[model samples]
Target: MLEESIRPDNLALVIVLQACGILAGKEVPVNEKGEKTMALEIGRALHYDLRTFMLEFDNFVCTALLNLYGKCGAMIEAENVFMSFVSLDVVSWSAMLSAYVDQNCGEKALLLYRQMLQEGLQVDAVTSVVVLQACSALAESERTLVIARNTRKTAALEIGRAVHADAYKKQFAYDLAVGNTIINMYGNCGVLSEAEHVFGVLNIRNIVTWNAMIAAYAEQGEDEQALMLFKEMHKHCITADEVTLIFALKASCSMGCLDVCHCLYFDIICAGRETSSLSASLIHAYGRCASLKDATSFLNELSEFHLGSWNACITSYAGEGDCTSSLFLLEEMKLMGIKPDGLTFISVISACSHTGIVVEGAECFMSMSCAFRIVPEGKHYGSIVDLFARAGDFSRVNSLLKSMPMPSDESVWLCLLGACHTHYNVELAKYAFDHALMVQPKHAAAYVALSNVYAYAGIQDAICGPKGTN
Candidate 1:
C-alpha cells in the first residue's frame, strides 16, 4: 500500500510500531540493553511520518509509540509520548510501567503505578501483570543489593500484597499471566502459603508455574517439598527445564541426599543440559552428600574450576563443621589467584564459629572490609556476633550489635538471645528479647528463650507480668 502511495491510517501505524517493538525486543532481552539500529531508525522514521502527515493520534497510537521507544531503550521518548496525553489510559500507564521494569527501574515503575492509581485509572490484567512484575523485580533487586552492598531494606512485598488485593477485587486474578506473576511475587517475598494459594487456584498451569512454585518451596527451606514437586511434575509428564533442574539440585544439596543428586545429575547429563552453573551445584551437592574426596574428584573431572565451584566446595566444608578443611580450601583458592566473595567469607566465619575460634573469625570478618574491600552482610554480622556470644564475650557482642550498619533481623537478635540463655546475662537477654520482638513481633521462640533467661535469674515476678515487661 505504501508503494502504491495509499494513505495509511493510525491503526496501520500502530501495527508497524508494535512490530518494531517486537523486533527491537528480540535484539535486547528484557533486562539488558543492546543496539537495535535498524528497528530504532525505522520506528523514528515512522514517528516523523506521523507528525508530517498530521495524522490522527490517539491512545492506541501513543501506546504503540511508547512501547516502541521502550523496547528501543529510549525511555525518555516513551515518557514524552505518554505525557503528551491529557487523560492517561490504562494501556499507556501499563506500557510505561513495563518500560520501567524492562529497563531495570523497578522503583520508578512502582511510583508510576501509584500515580496511575491516584488518578483513578482502573487497571486491567495487563496492568496487573506489569505492576506485579515491578514488585517482584524490586523485591529481588533490593534483596540482591542488600546482600551485595548492604543497603536499605525493601517493602515491595507489602506493595505487592496491596496490588494482589486489588487484582482479586477487580477479578483480574483469573488471568494466567496475572496468576503466574502473583505466584512469582509471593515467591520472591518468601511467602510460600500465598504462593500455594495462587498455584492451587490457577485454572491452567504451565512449566513456569511449576518452576515458580518449586523455587518458592526451595527458598523457604522446605527442601523435601521442593523435591516432591519436582517428582510430581515428572509424574504429570511435564519436562523439567534447566531452572527446574537447578532448583532441584539446590534442594538436594540442602537435604544432603547423595542418591537423589546422582539421579538429578544423570538426568542433566542425559538431557545434555550440563553447564558451568549446574556443575558448580553438583560440586556443592557432592561435598554435602558424599565424602570430600568425592567432591574433590568431581571438581578435578571438570574442565575448569570456576569461582562458584570453589565457593561451593569451601562452603560445603564449612557447613559440615570441617573448619580445618574449609580454611585449607580458602588458602588453596587464594593460591590459585582466585579471590573470595562475600559468600566465601560467610562460610569461613561460620566455620570459625563452629570451631569456637573467635580470633580467626574476627580476623576473617575484618578482612572482609580491610583486606578484600568487601562489605559485610547481615549474615556476616550475625555469624561474628554468634561466635562472640558463644565464647561468652558479651562486650564484643554488644559492640558489634550496636555498630551494625543495617537494621538487625530476627535471626541476629535471636542469636544473642540464645547466647544470653546459656551465659545467664539478664540485661543482655532483655535487650535481645525486646529487639527480637521488634523485628518479628510474633516470635514465640524469643519469648521462650527470654523466659529461660528469667528462669535462670529467678525473676518469677518478671515472668508474672506481661511478657516479662515488669
Candidate 2:
C-alpha cells in the first residue's frame, strides 16, 4: 500500500489504514507515538470534515472514530466529539464508555456513565461490561464493594441474568458474555467459591469466560486451581489467547513455579504470536520466580521487540537485584526509538534500590515525570522510598513521604521500616512504624518489625511501647 504514492486525503488510503486498525484489534501497539500519529492521520483523512462529510460518518463511522482515538490514547479528542452532541443513543454512550474502560480509565468511565444515567440515558450490555470493569478496578477496596453493590443494588447481576433468562427462559442462565461477566462480578467481589460454581455450570465457555475464571483463581492465589483450569480449558478444546497466557503465567510467577513459568514462556514463543505484551508477561513471570538468567535468555531471543518488552525485561532484572542489566536495558530501549513509560522507570528505580544505586535512583526519580512525561504513581513513589531507605537516608525518605500528592500506602512505609531494621536505624524505624500504623492500623507484620527494631537498638525498655500500640 505504501508503494502506491497515494495522497493523504485519498479515500482508499483512509479505508486501508482503518481496516488495518480493525484487523489488529486490541493486540496492536498503541503506545508508540509514530503508530498513533499514523492512525490519527488516517482517521482524519477518513472523516475529512466533521461538518461536510455527512454520508459515511454515521453512527458506525462515529464508533470507528471513537475506537480509533481511544486505541491511540487520544481520549480527550474522543470525548470532545462524544460529548458534543445534544442527543446520544445507547451505542454512542457505549462506545465512549468503552473507550475509557479499554484505556483503563474505569473511574472516569463510571463517572460519565452515572452522569448519563442521571440524564435519563439507557444502558445496555456493552455499557454494563464497561461498568463491570469499573467494579473490578475497585475490587480490592471493601468500600468499593459496598458502594458498587449498594449503588446498583443487584442491578448489574440482575440485568445480566435477565439478559440470559431472556435468551432462554427454560434454562434461565445461559449466555456467554453474561456468564463471563457474572464470573467476573463474583471474582471482583472476592467471592471465588461462587464464581467457581457459576463457571462450572457454564455449558459452553468462550475465551473470556475461561479467562475470567483463571484470573479469579490467580487473584485468590490459588495457583494449583489456576493451572488446573488452564489444562482443563485445553482439554475442552478452548484455545488459549494472550490473556490466558498472561493470567496463567501470573499464577506461576506468584507461586515461584520456575518450571511452569519456563514451560509457558516457551509455549508463548513457540506459538509464533509475539505481541510485545505477551513478551512482557513472560519476562515478568520469570522475574517474579527469580529466574533472571531465563528471563534474559527469553528477551535476547526476541527478534522483534519494543519498549514495553524491554521495560518488562528491565523490571525482571530489577526485581532480581541486577541494576546494571536493568539500566543497560533501559538505555537500549531508548536507543531503539521507544520511549519508556512510568512502569519502565519504576522498575529501573527499583533496580537502583536493590543495588544501592542511590545517586542514579534519586536522579531518575526526580526526572521521571519531567523527562519522560510519566507521572509517578504510588508504585513509583514506593520505589523511590525504597531507594532512599536502602541508602539509610532516613531524612530523604521522610521528605518523600511528606511530599506525596496522595497518602502513601502501607507498603511504602514498610519498605522504609525494613530498610531501617537492616541498617539498625532505630529512630527512623520508629517514625516509619508510626506511619505504617496510621496507614494500616491492624497490620501485624508492621508491629512485629517495629518490635524487632526496638529490641535490636537496646531499647528493650521501649518494648512496652510497641506492645501497648499493638
Candidate with maximal lDDT: 1
What lDDT does the true structure give each of the candidates? 0.83, 0.74
lDDT of 2 at 332: 79
Which ten residues in a row are the worst by lDDT in model 1?
145-154
Model 2 alpha-carbon drift over 4 Å, by segment: 1-172, 327-341, 357-385, 394-414, 420-470
lDDT of 2 by residue, 1-470 (tens): 44685333335433554684664354445564323655666666655543353533455556666667776667777887686655678888887877777666655766777787887965655666666665554443343434564545344444334433443443434467757877887776667887888898888888999999999899888888999999898898887889999889889988889988877876787788578888888888888888888888888888887666788788778777889888888787778777888888888898898888999888888777778777788888888999988888878887887889998777887888788888899877877777777776657878788787777777775432332464
- Indicate the residue-level lDDT of 296 in model 1: 72
TM-score versus the correct structure, for each prediction: 0.63, 0.65
